[model samples]
Target: MDNVSWWAVASALAAGCLGLSVPGLLATLPLRLRPLPRLALAAPASLALIGCVGVIDGLLHLRFHWSHVLIAAAVIAAVLWPIREKRPLWSCPRLSALLPVTASAVSSVAFALVLLHQVPSFDLFSQSYDNLFHLNATQSILETGNASSLQLRTLINTDRTLSTYPAGWHTAAAMICQITGVSIGVAFNALAIAVVSVAWLPGIAWLTSLVVPQRQRTAGLCASLLLGTAFGFFPYALLIWGVLYPTFLAYALFPSGLALAMLLAHVWLPRWAPAVSDQVRPWAWNDRWMLLGLAAVWWLGAFFTHPRSLVSMVLLIVPLVLWICARAIAVAWKAGGARRRRMLWWLGGAFAFVSVAAVAAILVVFRVFHVASRPVGDHLNGPQAQAVQTVWDGLWQVLTQNALVGLGLDMTGSLIILAVVVLTGLVIALRRADLRWMVVAYALIAVLFALAAGSNSDMTKILTGLWYKDRYRLSALLPLLGVPLATLAVLRIAALTRWPRVVALGSATIVAASGWAGLWAPVGAAAAHEYRLENVKTTDFVDSRQIAFMQQVADVVPADQLLLGDPWDGSGLSWLYADRRPVFPHLNGQWDPDRLLIAQHLDQIESDPAVCTALRHLNVHYLLVSTGEFDGGDPSGNKFAAIDAAVSQGLFTPVLSDGESALLRIDQCS
Candidate 1:
């Protein structure tokens, strides 16, 4: 069969397997329970198993041995075994009551996957180092037959190993790769789509169900759909998936953490039932245990999958823990002796389980990887730096110009609006003023975390300190907490108006529309591709003329020779020539003083005659410079002008020049 047919078969197989497994997993839950609740419990466990297996295989390089398979089976059995011990079944309100929530969850996942698949895949560029490290680690684990001493890096110039990414995401990708025998690209794509559908969507749905009243369930469902769609389907989501696939995988686990936190919060509060109401009694011990287990899975998944997201989770958890503590205290204060004792038991059990799981995750990350909490520095350049400068401007632009109409159907603006609407709705719905105050506090924490992490400073230091900054804006996941509250607020507002239902429905519609518009922009008919990366082909697409000239130089250079150039140019060229490793590829967050020294010396060798002579002694093959691109408009004003001048004055021979980039070969003394 042709490659196309092979890929088609693989795609079909992946879809079929996931479709069967997901539904079966979901079906295992008590049928009487709300769909969201079942998903909230099941999705995280499934994703955790998937991720753990992947990290083991990808980072540890463990083979798909029978032992590994047995471990996975054991994990699955452990999670599912509890379901077999049947308890008295309680009746829920109705399946019809959950249709809106279920539909919204399903629709959000479906839309995200469809949109993601429709986009063309791009060659992994600068971020491929992370992928390579993960791949290498997983391979090493398999080869050595040792999981415990699975060092992530082979070469360590820095204090941290180059492969020191969180093990969870790599393991998940590795497992998927092992199962499918597909390339990393396909494995990541499958995992990314599944992570959202299974973990994120369901988590959002469950959070909404727990908080929103039955009467206002539709609005809550709508709000969730708005937030999930806006956040999960943004352009950045696609960009991250295309370039930094693992980070995208980590992002998939983000929603699950929030869901777990919210689930725990609900258990603590046990919303009051009216005297006349016939709703079931507050959640039981078994239910609380189940939520705790699910929470544990999410928290573990967050830490393991992406260290960066772990930072974000740390930021979120502080307020969450405080809220839980306050609720427990309030319950104990108001309750009679026996009831107070029971509340204490519940609080202790929940906190102990959560605390243990958190500590275990920390030990795994720190002890296993030997990662230290260090101060931030130069690694803070590029998109993050740009993001810091533009964040305030972007926020202002969204609020003033497009608050009502919304910045038409693009991911970034839509996400900002979704966060705003959800927060507004939640604030309005607070039955207790204290709850409102807690929400405000959490929101403040999230904003502060985002500002610090995304700023022009070291994200790692901020994240190491905060822990929650790891996932960046994943605190946006908390906006989901406000979803239920917002629904009630809408209903309450509508009640004061003549056409209550219309006002509520209309308001929801406007919010959803605005969100959808912001995330899914209309592409021009003549646009080359629907997705940004798809517009350019990997085989040939030059963003800069200098890049094209550099490629030409690469064509003439021998495979074994080293060519030095600027950091940005070197990165793109290295990716293009599969066999070549640039003297310094753009730092992959693993660089230290030594690596920095190497990079600086390499730069010096490329530009300075004395340095070039020394580099030749060390066996440097060629020096490449793009005088035109480097100099604003005049080649003479370029940073490499001295090198160009020296080469002209018989210091080196210019072998090639396309009026853009130039290649110089140093003459050796015989």
Candidate 2:
């Protein structure tokens, strides 16, 4: 863990890339889209495949091996093989056609390097709040041989029979680690690096092309990747703040799903505007059905990755959904008969009912997750007017092509090239009716961001709660629409220049290097956090010395025994790190009575018959004691009030110690 192992990083990166993308690519090969869009769609497709296979394997009580994923992909490819368009007879294509693929690939590599260098270490984790739970859960999948989202709840609470955490991210990480033979920590870092761009770059490229064709040039592709990757608001902000890997993966994959959904809208419902029809492929009926089916699978995949992102995706695409329905109704009314009109009204009523039902279901999920009903965390701890100011700052940031809102970074240092283009793109989108919906979508997202960042009102909670009312998430979304608009503006510039492609490359460089437009502060902060964490004596659950001591735990303690420690205190990580199970595997869980008994009276084992009985029943002979907790808040750990009494009175045999971290055996119970 000292000097980084670049070879391990490389293998983990390759395996993570293949595990996340290959299955989806094979499944989507039957689609006739050009290279960029097709490639972008592959990742989510694979997510759907992997998550479903895990769930199925869980129901049937089967172990999840890496081969199971490949077999699933083969089955899907074989099933979809019949629908292949009968056109090409193995004819060689021109080299010009490969430009988009080649350029995008190169840009992805550059972007990936920037992201890695931004992080202090490619192997060590950032240890943001949620990572401990996610990391332990990924390890649990390998240990229990049950990767079903439903089965994941046991990792948090052994007493629970049913719960879900959208294990798509975990399932994929498990497979990557298994295939590459790397630790979960290394595999996860690779995923954090590779899984992000799998959907994003091509998705944005296809979207830019679809929105504004700009004379069928590769400049859009070039500009999209370069400018798209330069912005630190999105994918980078995510990797840093919460290290919100599940949401990060879901967001990367959602753009393609959104683009496909928009395409489906165009194909199924012809618009009054000619531009909408002209931009989309003229798919056959069979193709539409097939695409719809794949889109459904992608939705499931996104849900499996993280339901909140699916919620975000659904929220962002509301304008398009409303437009499609409105267009269909208008077309129906124009050719009206009383009977047909009546039927149209009935269908509209039914659609409205279903929409209401869906909204209700979303609200239910919000309540279940304790989101949106009340302010969460530090959303608005200041005065009321500061909320308004934050909203204004957010709008200003979006307009100026600054994604980091109020992070205290100097915004004026960067040149305004990207800002000017983003505004120009906004102007262009407003003028073109087909592109107008994008502006509408952007506005809707901005309003949501305002509610999230500025207000903690009940209505605000309802709207922003699913995201835990986090401005970082809402701010990150502005680029979901803004980045494509920026790419569109660059593509327009490229169209006018004699050297269009050169303009694309040069523009990305100016914005990136021009006072470090979007790349400066995020890179500094992320690197500082990641690199600093690597050397810190303590971070959240586990400490540096504690980690080294844990490496020796398995040698002294039998593999079949369990560790007694507070998950909050970090020693509970022995379950995942040292391959020794812990009585409490997470910070919180619906613990069984026996574990609860030991937690309350473990120090009284010499005199309390109940404590000894519970310890022996659970086979908990070893105790991992530490005085620290994640976030430096509550160090209650396993809640044994007199636990440290053992150290003072020699109640237990000391097995190992490194600073405050110690391992002990309960001899009195034996």
Candidate 3:
């Protein structure tokens, strides 16, 4: 990478930490959470702020800048200040508290190192299908200054009708780009790294600490290590598989969301509910309305980022909800000694009514997200296609610590060790009532993963269809609570050991290594490092040679000129990197008639008047033609066959050329 590229990546990483973290910390000021919980919750709050900023600018039709984020954050903090508790949100933590913080930092470094290994360059992007939309959408937000989720689908929608999309993730990328002046690609990679480290690593660490009995000083450290490195399927798997940017981010911050749910479930019901007033209560929060206000901020964040996170929240939080309801029922039973039958009926009626309301709310959410319209990918096989069976398959995978995604990382030794760890956790959950709800939550998501991954039944579609029956999406949701259970289990095992610190550190190292390469690999660290290095040593997408050539193309191709080529052939990226618009800016879409006509008959420009007319109408001034395409990624050439023929006939003059790719001026079109 050149110095400019290096600067872009470094600046993005640095600026992203401040831009992403501060807004959230300020936003959480009014909420009655401890400093630790507040710190953990900041990521989600920052996401909410960014999402709102994007939507606000979209409505105002103005360019986004660093000022917007800071100004909005300032406004939010100032407004919330009067209502803020006299108890400050931040204070120096005890030296002992820094154990979790230290674990968070060390674990964050490990997580980042692996991710940096996976995506080696800031310029690297997924060669997959969805990323084309993501890249184009991000560029559109940066260029047009419209970041509204409702309007983002217009980039591919053609008719300008409002199409639903979760633009928060894409918007954040654009924010990074504008703030740091980095290309969309680098900005994206930098933001992903930042989210994992600044947002996810600490969030999971705090959640794990919360799950442990507080006296278990090592809970945060163990949780950070276990959750960050012990598992390959999540936090890492999601990054590889769709590059699943939106889902990855939402799920990353989802621990905080889950933490919030746990907080409300444990504290709100018992303390604030009128029926439970007679019960022992201990929380500074006297107002139920204030708690709901905190939830509203999280909702706004989740809603804009991805509605699926909300559904994921509901899925995981159900067990807790049930637990809370069960407690309410018991409380009503005690209070209803005299009119027990009448009180029981009232309680039952309330439960039934709430259940119906929840169902209705879920349906509304599904409709808003256009869940029914999304494709389920039944034709395309996933990681679940092989090495697994349908019924209870996801359940089995979780229990055994099996990886569903391709790129084999499984080892017998690692499997045995992890299996014992996870199963011990499950066994522990069964005995501990407080942790039982987490197990329930993990099981529910796993069941969904199974149905999505293996089943093709009508019922499967109905049940998992909310995720469009995409196993990757379901699999990503599985680890939200799964890691915490694993963390608790490691803590339990450490308690039984003579050298708990050594055991904890060693276990953390071995498990993280197991996920990367193998447990017993030669000199544990060396093997894991070599394995990660080999995977990212060479990327399958566009290379530095191609990037250099593209930069040259950008110099020659004027901003006003439009390039025409197949998106599948990689010509669509001209818009993102070169600032030269492409006639086809994405891989596949319900394209307008003009673009389709040109795609079908661009070579017939001299013979076909319609082709000539379309070319002129669309302002075709250049052509980006790749002579050879990516392995298995090449288009059929049926659509671009015209352009290939035109170039073969020497109809256009090459402005520049790299071995198989070139930028040509469109004199032939006339």
Candidate 4:
């Protein structure tokens, strides 16, 4: 088979094999109880299995190759073989009615896949700044055969500590790349598209299935389609804008994690905390063990994939638990005397336990998300006008900005419309048990956003400490609350109007179109070959000539010698694609002491023996000069001045020149 064909086959087998594993089967149990088709479980199951594989590989130090993945799959299959003989995949009796919803979700994914496939070259490498670490880190995982980020530090800087960064995405991509002989970049991009299409799209459908009534599946499905398509920041913007592949993967898995938590909470809480039974109708399903197991596996998937996502789940889940406790206490009070005291004590213990657990979890989060070695008290810089503007901007963007809108559908207008409709629906059906949870969820998110939007430095620290204080990251999660309310609004409006279907379709169409507008450039950029240095500065087309020049330098430079190059000139790609390590692995040069030292005297390297002494210390071999786009405009302070000075002082000899860039051997270093 050709390389592309091999990649398809390998990726299919890796995902398929994972799906057939024990955790994969376990993860499908809760979803199986729903009236959805078996295929709905494929993506989530596959992703959960990938997380399982990551854990196994990390512990065993196994190389992330097809052989290792297959072995792990075999072990899981072996354990589950006896159970599979007795029970087959569940068949949905309502499959005929559910086909449209399923088809809509699948089609949305397929459309996204087509757009992603059309991107130029399919080289899979992102042109964004952050992709330097992401792409190189994946390459490191492949080279070392260690899927654990803890030990995968050789790619970026050898001085960096054991990494706490999530490695599940990299491991999955590395498996595809190793098995198919594709580049890590190609595998990574393909994996990302697959995640959005297969994992995220279906996962949303599954969450909708959990939240919406069985009869109203179509409304929920429609809402998911709009969410998958129309929302720009979530699956698309996060993928393209920040090139946050790990975060995207975590977010994609979040719906499934939430759905599983909802199921488990509904079922398990009643038995453990019976005082909370007034608010929760204890589900007495025969598959209780299966549901518990499924929730555990999904939570594991979330924790390993991205801690931020796991934290989001906790925030959402806590409100439901508190509501349950509050309801039980109210019911106990109505019953009077001993029952009230008993319920109080029960809830008091529960509250204490939850408090302790939350504190412990937050500590873990603080450590995992910590920005190591940075000066903490160096206050964050913001524009003078931003303090007040950010309060509104952060709150508004959290609610409405991520998705694209048009045809006079302003985000503020949309929010006002949706709020009016949802509140109207809640009043119309005040007895809905589900509405309570929905309201609680929305309220919790609003509170989080309020804290996030606070102008105080401490609030900023809290937000950053919790979710990187990134508005984009917070916005990426808005759809979870946004989509459900949107669906509710459409349904409520339909119930009020004589033409329900018309109202629903109209809302879906507006949402879908507006969202599609937001994603046009990002999706189109694939084929357009555009790359963004940052969100504001975008290069229309990737310059392949510059890439070729870097590759030539990589080929000539000794493997052990470190080269110095400006990261903004895309030297990180050389480390990833050409196996050449640049002094600065990331675009920001302020963090690394050694890199900062080199940068401080780069222009004086030819005349300054001290600078030459540092160069010799690093075993520096060459300097790469790019005649392309870079951060700073000054030629003197930038890489050009340093190169010109070196040449004038006869301290270096030009070994290769490609007009676009050049490689200078440090032959006359001090």
Candidate 5:
């Protein structure tokens, strides 16, 4: 990596650490010493740390390109520094803060262990199609020294055409590639295993602080630890599917945005009952403005990083804007002129900032990427159609069977159940006129928006053809969001009952148990099955065979050649091999002529001499086929029979085959 790049990454990390750790250090100060201190203290410390890291990277020769790490760290520091002094740390005595930190540390360690054990299995067989695109983009940039005109179509042999997928993710990876000059494998491994998890931690901490009360701060901290570790640390660590995709990063932002929104709402609402004698306070506006600012930042990040997330935010924000408007109107109607003026200013300012930020993001993305929004359509057909059905069924099973215990990682149903539960909690809380419950409701809606936006179906049909399947259900976030709300509910219920403490303890136990069961039963089972059946050591499946065949094809094809194939087939090809771009016939409801040529009538292409001539005319170098028959009926039980006959005529050469599938190299037909 260049000196500047190294400096950027190093500085980012240093800044993040300094910003996050400073609050804990301040918590050690006496209560009297903590009142109205200079908020600038944390900011300087974080900036200084970033500067130091940059200086060290420039001066010292650190082998690994620490630039991306530094950039991410610095970003975190910049975010946390301003809020550090303003937000109250849990009012714990010196030693008390250690308990939550300890809990978080333990959970982090456990999460690391789970990830390490599962990495080998996930890397070998599971399709990391998104990572392949990143690698392809990075390679093209490295070779050509230009980001634009670096074609994705040439890398994978498919006719789906380019422009369906966004370039931002690839751009980020290419930036990393420019610095490290390492294999794509190493770069992706670093991103999936480390960068994403670290980036998520601070937001998790901030959200935990918001949801957990002052008295139960330690437990809240523990809850954050549990949420982050359980949902993010453990599950993502064990599965290749979740962490490698941009959706994971985008989904993480969902909670952060929701938390900030809730905080803003809390600040805007009248703290005291509306009465003539009620006294107004200066600090009342603090949470409102702080939250609005934070929400704007999160929205911007989500927009640039992932489009699906941006879509989800819109769905969530519309309802919230209406809610805010209603509350503002209510406050204005009842309050005096002076009070009304202040409220209007606060509401207006908050709205303006958020609106500006969101609009700027949309315009920037469109301009930089040259993305044109497309309409959504029903794309699931054939095996994919069946897969979608199974996915839906699986989701339903998750909700019904493991509502409280949760269906664990890779289960969409758990997420749905959790959403339902949160909604139910919100309804109960709202009926009882509890402010906290309303906050949770808003948070849940925001999270749902993020999830829907990041969803594979949404992305494939709308933003880009990049799909991570059902993993985007984000069951982990459910637990993270649920724990504190459930805890509070338990506490409230206990307060009203004779056996309040017992009930509270019982509820906590049930939740923890449910979490443990969810973690172990279905998610663990799926992971274990994947590990046992498809690990690098053991290869015994159709997917593996397909992957190996595609790898062989990648070896022979020129780095710049594009392969045209079926959408499902193309995804598999692009994912398994580097520098091979597959063009699917239809992506995000758009069809490309080049992709259509390859997808049309393989059976006819095999039998007709003229079709071979036409294929060669189009510069088609090879044809790949799996076991299944094409749209036309098999010439025999074997779909490749007529293709085999064509090959025997010496027009095409059989380059590679695993007995079941084959790659036929196209030669000029004489």
Candidate 6:
């Protein structure tokens, strides 16, 4: 890492500390939490606060300067100094108490290493499709001094109205870029890798701890480790897929928000219906209002980070909420002592019903009315051949052949095996009518994702819109809930047998390692095929020549001029690397008259006067033509044909040329 990168890391650290301390200072909630879990809270908390800054900057167009960053740091320090004035900086805990924290730290480091091993370096952004938008958005935030999702519409179509895209991750990256003078790509990549690998593990572990009692801290550890290695589609596949950075950041923080919600509900349920209080254990923290306030804040953080995360978290928690309400109502109906008491209980039930109904109505409105206008595109509407093939190759191979493509071991077979274990745990938990709601909630989410990835197109589309229709996005939620249940199942199985403790621990460890390896199998196989990363088929995810060509384009094209080219062919990347704008930066339906004109006339620029007129009107001063055909179509030949025609007709002046790419400036027309 260079100096700027180091500074970015330092800034992340400071943000982490502030994130942890701010919540502590405000709620003193960590007083009830273990030391390590408190540290985990800092990561999301810092990101949330930084996200808030980004949101404000974007909405208000506030410049993110070094002074602003320094001021933010100073405020954090001021808050921390007073809070730590009387209390010890670190909590003193027994050695056994440190196991969960140690496991979490180890898992984070391991996950970071795994990601680094796969991604290798942050020199280039992931070749995932959405990175085009994310990188440009980061650049826009850096230039405009705010992470405005709406402002980024310029990349799509200059004429479109502001849209409600979440820019929290981009905003944080912009902050890093502003302060460190590193490239936006560097800042974005760095923050993403750090949060996902380092912060994400601890966050998951802490969430697991929330549901897993103090006695089963080992289960939490196991779950955290499992998260580090298992479910390649989630944390790893996301890196290679859309590389959905905002969703990744939000997902990292989601569990913490969930933990907070669970805590809030635990506290709230007792108050709303006292009979259920006997069933639910009392939280050590007495400040129910404070906890609720903190939970709400955490939820806001998730919302700002990514609306998908908030939606998913809400979906996961809805069952738990309903179950709690039902228990409360049941308790109220069962109360037979006094008329006044029964009336009060009924009143509490009514209040719960009204509150739940109101929240549900608001969410429904947000989804149906508010989000209907946004441009998510119907890309995943049809039954995708690739989805079916992926399922066949991944799950089928594991089941029938007893092997995954990359891993030499038969590790993937455990997906079925552990799935059974999870189901068994859920059944037992439900039979006892204990805290099985948590297991059920996650299971429902998992099933929803599976259904979204199902063979049927229409059902998949509807389910997919619920999660942006990305299986990887939906898959991210599974390990957080599944691992803990798996841990509990393992513990239960161990208790049933007279087997030595070592046998049980060893078995769990093997399962964790195998599950991790299994998940990596399909991802590794898919990487070479889908992305052309190492295995280099004719498909173009990215290449050295493209990178070199982009660098050349950056060198020749002025930052101020707009370059017209096919975004699908990687020409749009100049906006991120070269600070040049593209007429059509992406193919995701950001339509405008100018964009339509450019697209229609792109192949006719040299042959027709109208094409030149439209180009001039759009102020497209330059053309960037890449020689490669990509996902959209074979734009390489047509674009070059247009370029060649322009040069022949003396309509364009050649500025720079490489073998497969050329930069041409449109000549002044009479």
For all candidates in order, the CA lDDT equals: 0.47, 0.71, 0.67, 0.57, 0.43, 0.57
- Full ranking by TM-score: 2, 3, 6, 4, 1, 5
Best by lDDT: 2
Which prediction has the highest TM-score against the true structure?
A: 2
Roughly what TM-score does model 5 have, to 2 decimal places?
0.57
lDDT of 5: 0.43
Clashes of each: 36, 2, 0, 4, 28, 3
Could you tell me every candidate's TM-score relative to the true structure? 0.60, 0.88, 0.84, 0.76, 0.57, 0.78
Q: List CA RMSD, all candidates.
A: 9.2, 4.0, 5.2, 6.4, 10.8, 6.2
- Model 3, range 87-130, lDDT digits (tens) per residue? 75667778767666666666666666655553445565666557
Evaluation by lDDT, superior candidate among 2 and 6: 2
Q: Tell me the tens digit of each residue's lDDT in model 6 across 199-263.
A: 56666666656554455456446555554445454566556555667778787776667666666
**Weakest lDDT window of 10 consecutive positions for candidate 1:** 400-409
Candidate 4 lDDT over residue span 311-348, tens digit each:
77776677667766676777788888999899888878
TM-score of 3: 0.84
State candidate 6's TM-score: 0.78
**Residue 423 of candidate 1: its Cα lDDT?**
54
Taking the tens digit of each residue's C-alpha lDDT, what string does model 5 give over 40-145?
1222222223233323442453321325334545565565555455446545557755655565555554554444444343233223324335555455544444
Better of 1 and 2 by lDDT: 2
The C-alpha stretches of model 2 lying farther than 4 A from their native spots are 30-33, 87-93, 118-120, 272-281, 326-389, 404-415, 512-517, 534-539, 635-650
Lowest summed-lDDT stretch of 10 residues in model 3? Answer: 272-281
Q: What's the lDDT for residue 474 in model 2?
A: 73
